[model samples]
Target: MNGIRAFGATPSDLALDPFDEGTSSYSKAKDTSPIARLQERIDRGETKLSHDAQFGYLLSLMEELGVSTHSQLLVFSKTSLQRERITPKTPRALYFNDDVYLGFIPGAPFIEVSGMDSKLGGVFYSIDQGKTGRPRFVRTDQCLECHTSTKTLGVPGPLVRSFITDADGVVDMASGTSLVNHRTPLSERWGGWYVTGTHGAQTHRGNLSGREAFALHEKEPNHLGNQMDLRRFFDVSRYPAATSDIVALMTLEHQAHMQNFLTRLNQDSTSALRQFGHLNMKK
Candidate 1:
């Protein structure tokens, strides 16, 4: 419950420069991510990605990266970098494996992607969906603005957030948002998302896409609980899967932060060893 990040009360957090070349070297590090590896294969002509008329480059990219289509999860919150086109009717689809997360907006020009780096924690990239001879995953820095924060353990990492959203998928700032992980209670999870499955009595904030639903959550929180189908929320035909699985969502929430924790530990240990020299502890 108490930590250096909670209030910045300790100078310890400032001890390591995450971007320093000699330390973590987040920006300078040659990230050995799966996306980067796949890109190399394409550049060397060792492999080529398929682009389809129906799904664009989605299926091919997923195949190249080894991400399962069944791991798809839907988030309707308008808190994305590409928020202008996202809505409850056009929620963002995220498919992931243990090492990577790929985000797709139905009509967007490109697919957003992030993958784990042994040194950089999370490396962000994008793949264009338009017709082209060769597709490339361009690494970007803009994603770091939000991806690196106390919530991500001061590392460039992925996050699964929960917020109070309105009908058009706009988040209500007054309602406050939460950085979710496994530590988060089940009842408080999944706002601004569509979760399809059946839970007899348990409740979450998923499938509530109205201002009134947020307020009603104070009383009848389960007003939208246990939705076995998502046909009414959006066109199920538009996405890879009709169901935004609860198991996948929960696993994603936990995995995202577990990566951050690993990065934090790696960063701090590297920095501390360099700064204070080796420990002479009493074994």
Candidate 2:
């Protein structure tokens, strides 16, 4: 099969301005997002976080948000901004709720996060995992490079990328790629995640590694089984949870795509309101 060219070959990708704060809603009111409010809670001692290890802070945040450790899902793909820390053996752990997504890489300096805003749809943030002073929740704009693009319909949003990966978790774009969502077929899902649930006899592209790029097989949902033990993959002690529950992965896929749609809607309404004001002033 012909290897598809790089994603950056497209004109829109070449023209992408990730730091163009001029148009992003985040640049305008980042300080008002839910993440920002969470920081305020920290300041008031309403939410306490340990300034020690990343896990401590992660655990605290999860507790505050009602996210269970049981909801853990591991992704070995280098599909995030902190690609350097991802690998097949040490996958990034993801936890989510109806309104937020929390990402933690084993040895990364910070935890990548996003929370839904009533106005902005999805707001990006990074909490310093190594902070000695007050833990800083910095609003990040770099995420827009991937979150705001044709893939997301040109707004800040969540997206899931499915592709064949090498041993180190680097995607082999030449093989193939799929923009996954809840609607995506189960067989075409979870290319680089460790799914730990039984789905009858169904099979998926999870929990496998090879020396070279290889296409995923057609996995019947019945072949997949619910797995609660993940000690075989890595030391379960290092993480807060052991199971990479398949149910959580399925929920993540659904919410991620929904978040993208919400973001675009927010941006559209904001733009339209501005246009209406300009036309009214002319009358």
Candidate 3:
């Protein structure tokens, strides 16, 4: 049996052997992005990171990558594949720019990252907690298991989802899944996210959850606004910023879709190139 079903096999078992250094664009591509190139520098003891109480590296990386704090969006629901660290009180904050999305979960072992590559589409990395010198950013293959699925257009990419969650932040998967994009109706968006902007009389599934199946109404007003304080949920000061602006959430939705499109296009072009090369070899 391959690594997928092998009992004691680790997640990297398959990705390490034949494909790790050969076929995987993530491992082969050199001139990709700043984050992609950092791995080699880290291996060469060239990159040094300073520590912070609540992940100072995340902020420093954002600054280095030109990601703005104004791009903050918080998801309080346990919608993450890494559901253990996510909760209503300790929500996960997502920050992004044109080419990258950074996921920071307080008290978690690693900070998640997904970068858009011109050729590889999406490349995932995790900066783990290393008590020694600088913390190392390790390239991970596990993210592709979910990120490269049908939801991401059959290529490694990003996605945004909303879920019906309980008070403890556990998602009600039995209630089914809802994926949101720019074209999705406003009322149907942000089911598990915390919106912090004025939408006037607009209502969404955000900022509300219960044990029972509660129906969402169209006319019901969403009281969550810019003045709402998230400090009540958790110590907001632990982060670089506090507010999870609604405008940021909207932008995230749009970016996720566009990233998927770019990823699919890249995959197609890569396959075409390989096919042309094989054809030429026959002559």
Give the winner by lDDT. Answer: 1
True-structure lDDT of candidate 3 = 0.68
TM-score list, all predictions:
0.90, 0.81, 0.79
Writing each residue's lDDT as its tens digit, candidate 1 over 15-94 gives: 33445455666676687999889988999999899988767799988898889888999999997789987899999999
Task: Compute the lDDT for candidate 1.
Answer: 0.82
TM-score-wise, the better of 2 and 3 is 2
Candidate 2: segments with Cα more than 4 A from true spot: 1-24, 51-54, 211-228, 276-283
Assess candidate 2 and give its TM-score to the true structure: 0.81
For candidate 2, the 10 contiguous residues with the lowest summed lDDT are: 1-10
Give the Cα error of residue 247 in candidate 3, in Å.
1.3
> Per-residue lDDT of 209-241 in model 2, one digit per residue for the tens?
554324233333333235557777677777888
lDDT of 3 by residue, 217-242 (tens): 32335444333677766778766788
Off by over 4 Å in 3: 1-31, 40-47, 212-219, 223-227, 270-283
| Residue 244 accuracy (lDDT) in model 1 | 89
The segments of candidate 1 whose C-alpha lies over 4 angstroms from its true place after superposition are 1-22, 215-219, 278-283
